[model samples]
Target: MPGVDHCLQEAMAIPGAVGASIVDYTTGFPVATTGAAPNSDHEAAAAGTADVIQAANSRSLFVSAMPHDLLEDLIITTAGGYHLLRMVQTEFDSRLVLYVWLDRVQGNLAVARRRMQKLADELVAT
Candidate 1:
């Protein structure tokens, strides 16, 4: 079972990964990070992404017709790269997300997503 740091390192090992972090969506705080921006400004990214996740989560509440799937990870694709967010399912109280930044030209989206899912499953909160 991987801890936060180990999981983050694994995330960054993905092909074309620019940076990776585990964030607490509720507080917009990163629990662990690597390859983060110049000054480790992942805090801002966490806060921003958390808002997006929250919005999607909120929609699932009022929309009865919504599929049983409700909300899953969020992905944003830009001309330069891809931003992938995988929500971690844990037994504890923390609502965590795995955030990965990848180079658009080098990253394989399908592979990245699959690996992220595996990483999420392997996580064991401590």
Candidate 2:
């Protein structure tokens, strides 16, 4: 398994990748990051994205339908680019998220998502 640093490096290597970070949602802290910094302030972006994840996870309409399903990931596509958030289950923490910002014109959403999922699966905290 790749450690957090290695995982972040691999994430940044993805085509059209603008930024990437591993966030601990419970505390709104980023465990690792690379490429462009979100919002010129990674801390703020980490906090904000944590809120996004929490909001998505709490929706009764979605969660009620699959009570046993843990959130896998969340994607937000904009006119200019895409924000992909992949959840990583950890033995040491209750919540972790891999967030990557990609350029829409150059990125393949399907490929990025698949690679992100694979990275999440191989990620291990160091």
The 0-to-1 C-alpha lDDT of every candidate, in the order given, reads: 0.83, 0.87
Worst 10 residues of 1 by lDDT: 62-71
Best by TM-score: 2
With a 3 Å backbone cut-off (N, CA, C), the pairs that clash in candidate 2 are: none
- TM-score, every prediction: 0.87, 0.91
lDDT of 1 at 37: 48
Write down the worst ten-residue block by lDDT for model 2: 59-68
For candidate 2, write residues 1-126 as lDDT tens digits. Answer: 578788898998888899999998988898888878666788888998899988888854674466577788899998999999999987874688999999999988999999999899887534
Query: How would you encode candidate 1's per-residue C-alpha lDDT over 3-116 as one tens digit per residue?
Result: 788988999999999999888888888788889642458888878878877876775565335567645588899898999999898877878888999999999999999999
At residue 61, candidate 2 shows an lDDT of: 64
Q: How big is the positional error of residue 86 in model 1, measured in Å on the Cα after superposition?
A: 0.3
RMSD of each: 2.7, 2.0
